[model samples]
Target: MSTRTAELLASIALIVFSLGLMWTVHTDGLKIGWVPERGPGSGVWPFWLSLGMALTSLWTLVRWFRRTTPESRNEAPYIESDRFGLVAISFIALTAMIFLVAIVGTYISIALFLGFYMRFVGKHSWPMTSATVLGAVISIYFLFEWQLSKYLPKGLPMFEDGFLWLDNFRWEYFM
Candidate 1:
């Protein structure tokens, strides 16, 4: 298909996906408690993000359809040669990471992913790569696990149900 056609297809797909995501989040519930207003539920961020994505996708779709002149069409390559391999590899790595997350903790999987990505894809020096991984791991831990007093996913073996304790959706003694 032509580049403009492909762009329109992608935009439509994104709009549909974002709408689905928004529906899920709203159905999942955004508030923790009814009376006290204790905290935001797991769906809060996703709901707003999905809304924004949907709106952006809709705007792009409208613009793509309204191309009044040949000059209005984008001239840039639909998929740059330099980025094709990187994009494919990224999708593969992401799928693998999702599978790995079910077996290991999020922190461990994310830390390893960050380290490898920084070292390989970013082509950074050893010290810089290590520092980036360390910083990411530490920041995530402090924000979610320590400061917020929440538990991230530890996979099925350790956590059994694979739900984070900080979410408070389940009643685990350790939590």
Candidate 2:
């Protein structure tokens, strides 16, 4: 609960992360050697960078054990209970948004995300959230699909789908 505990936990996490990075670099064929005629291989930079991170985290771990720093002297709690809930909610929302994007199109996913964020987090009224979502969807549809003629991910067989080649539809042709 104290700052010292938080620092130690973070250091441990960093150590684990650095180990994973080292494993990835090794698996990816990190070649630290430079060719005679050419420059270093792709893995050279990553190999050294990961090595540095690993060493730094190890140092941090040592520092935590020593508790010699001013930050360690202060025993303030790292994360308050109230703020943790907000962080958890935001993270869950992001995961749900990804799932929604895969099931629905990007347009609908963004609209839903904005609606949730506005109504719940921002404490906006339903009408304001709805209008904002609608306006955003329309802007995205026009800017990316209509004007730029780009193909974005579409969901469903009907209205929920984006990038419907509606850009190709000419008013003159209809006339």
Candidate 3:
């Protein structure tokens, strides 16, 4: 598809998605207004953000209809033939990582994704790729599981058991 057609379709999709998000937030019983003394309600930010997104999407649609934006006027293919391979590779890698999250866990999946992307796609040195993957996994573990106390998906039973053992070891020795 052409860039202009892609932009038009994207804008319309965004508008619909934003409106749906707003509606869902409103229906979840979280007040989307200022509370009496507690300040902004729980749904206030999400509702307002979605509203803003919808408004911006509407503006984009208007611009598209008027052909006022350069993207709206451009008739070039959305994905050029030269860049299609890279794009397809990236998409497939991402899909594989997401799928792996259910089998190998979030951290392992993320590490694999980073390693593959950095070493192959980015053509980075092995040391740099290893450092990046390690740092990312450690940081994510510390930030989410440690500080925020939010347990991410740990994949299958074996992986979950391994993580549980690690957590216990940390609590016993470090904490």
Candidate 4:
């Protein structure tokens, strides 16, 4: 598909996905409370996110019709043959990452992604790359585990028992 067409469709899809998220959250008894005293309920975030996505999609549709931007002009081919291989490789890497997550878990997969991109694609020093990866994994672990009080996926059999035990402390702030 042409870049313009792809963008239009993708934005529309995002809007639809956001709407579904908002609707599901609402239907699942999550109230979109706005009062300061009551605080923002779970549905508020998804509802606002859906509204933003819908507005962006509408803007994209308008741009597609007006052809105001250079990309919307649609003069050039969508995917040049030379860049096709790079696109394919990127998708392959993403699929590999998904499998990695299934095997290792989310934090490890993210660290691997950062390491791969930083070392191979970005051509950074090993020390810098390793530090960045470590930082990212640590931050994510603390964010979900401590701040959000949520347990991320830990697929390895060795870690499963540990994670199940950790799950009990999720609401206790993981301290």
Best prediction by TM-score:
2
> Of the pair 2 and 4, which is ahead by TM-score?
2
The candidate with the higher lDDT, 1 or 4, is 4
Q: Model 1, 24-114: lDDT tens per residue?
A: 7777766423335656666667877888999998888787879843523966666777888899888877777777787887876887788
Q: Candidate 2, which ten residues in sequence have the lowest lDDT sum?
A: 159-168
> How much does candidate 3 score in TM-score?
0.62
lDDT (Cα, 0-100) at 165 in candidate 1: 44
State candidate 4's TM-score.
0.50
Order of candidates by lDDT, top first?
A: 3, 2, 4, 1
lDDT of 4 by residue, 1-175 (tens): 7877766677678778867877888789887777667888877887777778878777877877788756777746579878887787777777887888878878778888888878887799999999999998888878877788676788798757766676677646644
Error of 3 at 67 (Å): 6.6
- CA lDDT, every prediction? 0.74, 0.79, 0.96, 0.78
TM-score of each: 0.51, 0.76, 0.62, 0.50
Model 1 weakest 10-residue run by lDDT:
166-175
Could you report the Cα RMSD, in angstroms, for every candidate shown?
10.9, 3.3, 5.7, 8.9
Give the total clashing residue pairs for model 1. Answer: 1
- Superposition TM-score, candidate 2 onto the true structure: 0.76
Question: TM-score order of candidates, best first?
Answer: 2, 3, 1, 4
